[model samples]
Target: MNSRQIKLTVSYLSILLISCVSGTHYLFSVYSISIQERLNFSSVQINTIGSACNYGVFLGKPVLGYFVDNYGARRVCFAASILIFAGFSCLALTYEKIFPTSFLLCAFYLFWTGVASSGGAVSFLTTTAKNFSSNRGTAISIPLALLGLSAFIYSQINMHFFDDTFHFLLFIAFTAGLCMSFGSLFLVVIPAPQHVSDTIESGSNDSISRDDQRIEQTPLLNKNNSNTINRDQIELDIGGWQLLRNKDAISMILILVFFAGTGLMYINNVGIIIESLYHASATPHSDAKIKNLLGFHVSLISICSCIGRILIGPLSDIAKNYFDLSRICSLLFAGVWLFCGNLLALLWVHDIDQLWIVSTCIGLGFGVLYGVAPTTCSEYFGSRHFGFNWLVFKSLNLM
Candidate 1:
């Protein structure tokens, strides 16, 4: 209810909107089949194109984070909006064979769009992490949860607004880009408490400016949190390479790699996976039926994924605050669902209907993993170097 909280609320809404639009990259399967058929793309080629968006996010994270750290998220988000707009526009044109490019070129265009989307996504995460100290988990969960819901939102949009595949692509380009532009216009970065601390301590505050003092007195820096936050910041400042040498850092990376790999394998190959399951069960399908089935599964995945992401943040807070659980414990909790999902898919998923359960668990697990990892990474490494550190460690998600 305070002005600071109000500003935080506004920023939260902006970032969530941006994330919801940009994170549609995860729904590549929805349009991949149509694209493949139209372009006469091979399976490998289609997969490569689908993976390009994520790869763009993975590869661009460090760069985007660096800009976010130095210049703040607003500028970076604006640039991202432009990139997404141009990339998608170019993609639509390419689909129409306007430039007569190969599939590789098309993949590159998608990759470029993804890079832009990553800027928006990372900006949101970094902004939230930098601004909030208490309840960091819940703060981040808001936007990230929406990001997980992107697929569902897009699915509904396609189902209701756009009838054809080609039109859907154009609409994504126009609508998502417009949303990103609006988000960029609205986003504002809050200075970190530590930075404000240093400024006040350095005699930067005039006599009448007592807000800084009140800020210093805020419970965000009490004995319980300040010590932990300071310690994390110190460890994060130990240089990225040196921090990489830490056992905790290595473990986090490996855990992310494992969970991310499990989820991404399904995401990238979702269409084929569903088809294979349908065939195995001798489920007869018309084109409309297949599309409907895929949409239903995707909707389920998005719904569960969003719910998992939103809930896990607060759950981690509970475990951390009440049970004195470490970040690793929160991570292991995430791994539980990932393991179960994969296990069910591998051992028991012999029919189309059973794949529904697998998708739910996998989506839930993936969402939870993404939800907590960034703030946890910032806690372990330090918020100062969070951008680069998170990017490096999180590359495992792409793998």
Candidate 2:
């Protein structure tokens, strides 16, 4: 392979590995019951950590993505690896009762994981999208899909490697740190060549419709051509806060909030959902049965999510390019699908046995929501300022 192609390959592989760490938030479901019992915390208390982690992720992303834009991916990723180690280490210490303030220390763990995810994810997504401008959807889908699988990866690790929950925390800290540190080294954001702008301006007039011209709207690339002209065709018309004021931007932020909120509810409560639904008490409920069921449910969600992320991105890209689909329209369809999934979860949840179907639907829907966001953001706001703009728009999820 040529040097640029090799760099792109390394970019993809690095993002995939680090993306594994980004989904550490999902592990709350698998490990929560164990953490609750050992730490003597209430269900509400443990669930709060999940919420805290979610909150921290959104809070950190805007800054982290912007930093990746202005500074560089490597420096932020290095810090991210350290945060993962420190966060998990603190969780290990807190569980051992070594920390004086247990709740505060636990909150720190949540923040650490949250911050780490943003750090890793921003770099991964931005790098991949830039490297493969032609197949932007397919490019990002690889990492995003693997990120969804991260929970499953860690669940397997927890089950096989450590009998004790505390030790598993340490393992997570070490493994995540090592992966992030190493992965960061190879993440290089190849700059868009300077002549790309002149090429797009000259080539785009025929394809852009009248309405698109009036609004200064442009497709993500030269849709009629085989090779992409993303950098040149970018919407320099609006960016930063100005783009946020646009209707598309506002709508996207709201949709993501709803989408992410729905997923978070199910994910944070998976342990309780299983216990209450299946009646998995310590005595009456078989521990083996509980573990098996819990792991199974997490895996089902992870697999569906992974597959959905892989599929929806490229599919949406095709519809947008080939069919002249509006970016917002494509997203709304995904949002509708997500809403339908949640509706089905409410309707069919007569028993725990039915929960898998519900989780599957939710996973697919969430995959669509997430996969669309960055690609859409890059298309809508322009990749030139994508990292900061995307992080800003995505902060609505935090709200």
Candidate 3:
């Protein structure tokens, strides 16, 4: 194919693969209650496992980034997909069998799944950054918007089909296997740029005289300058331990950890909060039915989240270029929205209508962070080392 065709094909496939991975989060949310009931665990225990899984995501990306940089994106992408498949298989088996397993195995299942899927977001972002230097913001935004579409679709399916614990686990395993298998097969390597040289000569006599004089008089000087330039160009290959030495990187990591920890906490618990409020306020007979309606409330949040992701990236880009504000401002706005969303949930949300309003607001606000943070890190650190740098930042979010 020609250059334009190649670019279009890569963009489409990358977005499709990335969206599949992002949709896993939605799947997990939908299955959370069912899994907890089947596993015979308390809400606290399930939340702890969920937190550990998020932490696993924080740890997995940087290790994958190192491999991605050394080997190639295609290898990392394929490997991650395989891991995801294996993880889901294990989850299915673990749930299906009547084994009296310890908490550690449960944590392991959650952790590995998180790790396996961690590469999905950044890998796609890196692919977009490499492919579209001019419209990187728009490219990133489009896939992210598609990822949000998963929420909309999955919410409906989850509401309708995830009626029993066994069916839910089967669905998760089947979908994960199918998506990973197809995505791995279709994953493409972006070709390196090809260069063509042009030959032109002007003032040949004068150039020859200058070259001759320089060669004779400054051989040592030229060698020294060349050595210095080479040394300057040499890059650092530090892992997470070494990266923590840099204060700026450390600070960024801390910020991401706090943001992700609280942000996910809010996202995960919103439905539960709404259900509790509805049950407490509703008539006695209506309480059980209202509790079941939590599924609808969670779905609304997912839809709002999708909307936010679709809008935030492009909006941030425009604000950065036109208003000449820092991109961090957009992230800060997202944070504010999240904080406000949680506060609203705690203070307000008495009925179903109030729940929808609050959930949508929170969903939109959370989307800002999801959409903007990865792109912001890519912008801050040069894209050449983005795999390493952004992985570090992403790991923090996992925590």
Candidate 4:
């Protein structure tokens, strides 16, 4: 890739990283406790808010994809960033007052955040698809890894500043505002290559020329001329539904659904698991120590998640080249890590180290899954409708 392509790639990746990290910073298990305490909410009420966010993501992805496909990525990305900024600002400002009724606040915040984040996903994937065809897998994976790093940074910030809920909200709002302002401006200039349009036109012309030559060369009296004619080549166009009907596409979508769903479940629940484990282990005498330990565990998980995101993409590229494994195998490995992480948490009774180890494992697994899944979708579906296709699969998984 040239300098421009590299710059664009880095910018998009940065935007994606910021969006994810900013949204997730306050969504971790520690925040759940803070929100509950501030608003006097029951556990059930808090869970309901989480469910709302998940369902919003499930419903919003397809709509966002369609908009991205019809319009352009720049508009969608800018708008989404604005929404994310607004959502986070709202979340930070009202989290204290919004508690049990905060379900409404959370739902609203999640709906916009979902819309914004989905746009970032589509934009980044499409940009990467446009830039590097041969190393597309690596390109996609790299951004996911960066997102992990962002998560780590955000988690640390939360851990340090989260003692005062009101102050934390202000800090999040200010940070999100800056990211949105810069991210939107940065995204506007990410030029789509002229060669993309040229290539499509050239491919279409080549198809037409080949069809004409074949028709002319064939004997008019040939019995099977019709059968020999390649309709797909002649048409030089394929619809999204036609692509979806392919067996490979169907299989790929199913795999992506499982991959995304399980990956999200882990991301959403890992902190909760750690907190609960620590809370359960600590006696009344050791409450403060256990709470501090749990905070440390959250920080470690965040840091590991960042490391995993940065490394997983490059590692997967190496694995794909060296081991000659399919992308599905990479995804399966991530899934296994998730299962093992959860199992470790379930079986290991009271050890903080065990909990931290499991959290780290889960973070690594999430990094791999997030990094590889979108790239796999692009490989199977082609880049033209990548956003729409990915959203379709992601929506299914979220549902």
Candidate 5:
């Protein structure tokens, strides 16, 4: 392969590693009860801590996205390494009572963890979306899928290798930090070769560089991509107030807020829901059994979500190319799943075992919704300002 191809390959793999480490926040359930029981925190405090982490995840991203867009992902990854390591280390110390136990203090640390998560995510995703314009959906989905699987990976490690919650937190800190540090070395934007005609048509300066003219003469842009949508849509560079004024952008924000909010509620509190159901059923299972079930459900959700992320990307590509359908079809399908999942959770889930059904639906729905969203934004708003636009779109989850 050529040097540019090699760079793309290395960058893709590096981003995958960073993504796997970035999602430690998804493992909140694995350690939430331990923090509560050992530190004497109430349910209200526990929920608040979860909220703090989530708020950091979404709210911190706009700034991080802006930096990633302007300064490149390397600096963002390095900064994320520091934030995640410090955040998790502080939480571990508090859990062990090495630091005085304050719920607010723990919440503060967890918030940074969330911010760190967003930093890693925004960096990798922005790089991917910018670099892989031809098959952006398939390209973005791999890392996104791995990110969904991160909670499962960590939970299994904790279950097998660490008995203490303190050690588990430390493990996440070091592993995630080191991965981001490593990824900083390779995560970079490889600019898509712009065709001069397209650039001129988009109202660029009439002047064209020698390199641009040479690339335009090559067959690079002539490759058969029957499965991809219109290239003109992909070249849109609109941003700032123009993007905000867009009716499509406004509609996306509303839809994502509703769907993402529902998914986050279930994701953040699935552990509590499982506990309540177990208790209500009057089952005589041991605490150990309950813990095992919790891990099982978390893993199950992660697995299903991973599958959904992988599936939706290529499916949407196929739909657009083969059926002349819009990406909104995928979103509608995800909405159906969310509606059914929530309905089932409310009306049908009484036993812990039956909870897997709800988990399956929600996981798949959440995965597809998120998986389709970034590419949709890039297609609709343009990858030129994707980092800022995508993150700003996601920040609506705060509502």
Candidate 6:
């Protein structure tokens, strides 16, 4: 391969590796029971720990996105490695009884895991979105698919390789740490070729069809410094209060908050749901069997989610490019899928055997929503401010 091809290859690989490890929070359901039994913790405390991780993921993003957008991703990624190692290591030590089992402390440790994951994700995703503006859908979807599969990868490793929760936690700690550390070397935004930049500038502002531009009505000014708006590519970058004030941006944020909140509610609590169903079932099963079933569901969710993320991107691109359909159409489809999942969970899925239907639907819906949301944000607000803009939507999931 030529030098440009080599750099692109290395950059994509590095981001994929980083994204794969960044989503350790998704493994919570797989390990939640083990942590509870080993730590002698109450259910509330366990839930608190899980909530801490989820909160960190959302809350940390805006700050991380700001830094990544302003200062570049390498330093943010390196810092993420340290936080991941420290947070997971401390949790592992606590699980092993090497450290005192304090509920608050445990929650605190897991919070950092969320923060690190957010930082790493923003770093790589920002790079990808900025680097591949023309093919953002396919390029961003690949790393996102790996990220969604993170739980599956780790869960399978735990089931086959490690018997102890301590070892499992340690495995995650070192593996995620090393991946982020290594990725920092090559995960960077490449400057688009001048010709490509010129084309994008002319095409985005001038050639956009009325139907294709669903989000922004007119160009927005940079509230902080009016001169910062790129005159060459009008409407390509808008940040701060101005973007937030736009009706389109507000609508997208609300939609994301609803979708992401529902998805996270199910994702974070699927373990408890599985255990409850197991207990209610007339057919008796061993604790080990129940544990295995939970792991299976987690893996199933991860697999379906990965598929959805990967599938939705190209499909959305096709819908927009060929059919001239709005990208928002994909969002509506995902919303309907999510609604069906919830409806199924409510009316049916009383039995353990029937749970997979809900898991599949929920996972696929969740993944598709996330996959399309970021791409939509970039298209609407412009890729230059995408790091901060997308994270703003992501962080609103906490609401």
Highest TM-score model number: 5
Q: Give TM-scores for every candidate, taking all chains together and pairing residue i with residue i.
A: 0.88, 0.89, 0.79, 0.79, 0.92, 0.91
Ranking by lDDT: 5, 6, 1, 2, 3, 4
Which pairs of residues clash in candidate 6, taking residues 3 or more apart in a chain or in different chains? none
* Model 2 residue 395 CA deviation in Å: 1.8
Query: In candidate 6, what are the lDDT values of residues 1-399, reduced to their tens digit?
Result: 777667888899999999899889998998888899888999999999999999889899989989998999999999999999999999999998899899788999999999999999999889888777545677788888899999999999988888888988998999999999999999877776666567556656665663234324322222453222232244457777888899889998888878777888888999999988988999786878877887898999999889999998888877766565777888888888788889999999889899999999989998898788888888778877788888888998788
- In each prediction, how many residue pairs overlap at the backbone (N, C-alpha, C within less than 3 A)? 1, 0, 1, 4, 0, 0
Worst 10 residues of 3 by lDDT: 195-204
- Tell me the tens digit of each residue's lDDT in model 1 across 264-327: 7887788888766776676666667667777887888888889988998888777766565776
Residue pairs in clash, model 4: 98-102, 99-102, 145-309, 148-306
**Better-scoring candidate (TM-score), 5 or 6:** 5
Candidate 5: tens digits of C-alpha lDDT, residues 95-161: 9999989999999999999999999999999999878876678888889999999999998988888
Cα RMSDs, all models: 5.1, 3.5, 8.5, 7.6, 4.4, 5.6
Instruction: Return whichever of 4 and 5 wins on TM-score.
Output: 5
Query: lDDT per residue, candidate 3, 285-387, as tens digits?
Result: 4533643566676676667777777788777777765565666777777777777777876788566567676767677777777777666666655556667
Per-residue error (Å), model 1, residue 313: 0.8
lDDT assessment of candidate 3: 0.62
- Which 10-residue window of candidate 5 scores lowest in summed lDDT? 225-234
Error of 6 at 5 (Å): 2.8
Clashes of 6: 0
Native-to-model Cα distance after best TM-score fit, residue 156 in candidate 4, in Å: 0.8
Quality of model 1 by C-alpha lDDT = 0.77
